[model samples]
Target: MANSNGSKAAARDKRQRLTAAAAEVLHRQGVERTTIADIAQLADVPVGNVYYYFKTKDDLVRAALSAHADHLSLKLAHLDRDPDPRARLGALVASWVERRDITARYGCPTGTLAVELDKREPDGIDTEVGQLFRTLVDWVAEQFRRLGQPDPHDLAITFVAANQGMSLLSNALRDPTIMIREGERLRRWLDDLPT
Candidate 1:
């Protein structure tokens, strides 16, 4: 029984490691370029062991997306620290500003991944991949609604679109300054909102 329990624990650890490695590789190399071998090597697990955890690449991709969603949720949860909706919105913009270099280099993690999945799998995985953006949009929209915006949903979507645009341009141009400038503009826009 102890041996069986130990084996189960080892299996669980391997599965978690594979998911984490897949997320990193998928974000950096993208789904098209990433392979089971790449993820296995990165995770330090045997290539054949990958099959024991994820039946297919899509399965691994889904697991990676789940991990990414969990991570994003944790980061966004930081906004709850501030009671003011405007302050939370500003902080959201600021978070992006702080990652200007990363965004300029790799683009927005969720946005880029969603585009890649949408292009390749389209109807199959696009919806699941989009949940990352959807959750974010919902949270931002809630903040806008709390701030008494008449069109909170549209405003929230616009905010996400602006951030995505900043990430896209910054990554394309390889210029962190673009993201920083956009962050400033977003903050200014937030400040301009009526009380």
Candidate 2:
């Protein structure tokens, strides 16, 4: 029984490592350019071992997208600790500012992946990738609703759209400072929203 438990633990650990490495590689290389070999090397697992956990590259990509969705959900949920809706929204934007360097270098990880996947023949991953945005927009809209905004849904979509635009411009310019500046602008915009 002890040996079985140990084996299970090891298997879980290795699968987690592979998923993390897959997310990083998918983000950095985009799906078309990343391979199972790249994911295995990044995870420090033998290339063939990756097949044990993921049968196909698309399977790995789906895993990465699922992982990202969980991450985004947790991150947004974390913002709920702040009592003020405005502050919570600011916190969400500030989280992006905190990763400006990475965003500038590689673009928004989810955004880039979604664009890459959409450019290809309609793969099922697009819906998965899109859920991340939908989740985000829903959370933000909920915050707006809590603040008694009449058009919470529209406001949420606009806010997310602005952030994506900023991310795109920041990547194009290779300027992390753009995120910082836009974050500050968003803070002001958040403040100015009708109470």
Instruction: Name the candidate that leads on TM-score.
Output: 2
Q: Give a tens-digit lDDT track for model 1, residues 1-195.
A: 999999999999999999999998898889899999999999999999899999999899999999989888997898888999999999999999898998898898889988888787365678987888899999999999999999999999999999999999999999999998999999999999997
Cα-based lDDT for every prediction: 0.92, 0.92
Look at candidate 1 and give me any clashing residue pairs. Answer: none
What are the per-residue Cα lDDT tens digits for candidate 2 across 1-195? 999999999988889989999999998888889989999999998998889999999999999988898899788778888899999999999999999999998999899998999988886788888989999999999999999999999999999998998899999899999999999999999999889
Model 1, runs deviating above 4 Å: 121-123
Models 1 onward score TM values of 0.94, 0.98
C-alpha RMSD of each candidate structure in angstroms? 1.4, 0.8
Where model 2 places Cα greater than 4 Å from the true spot, the runs are none
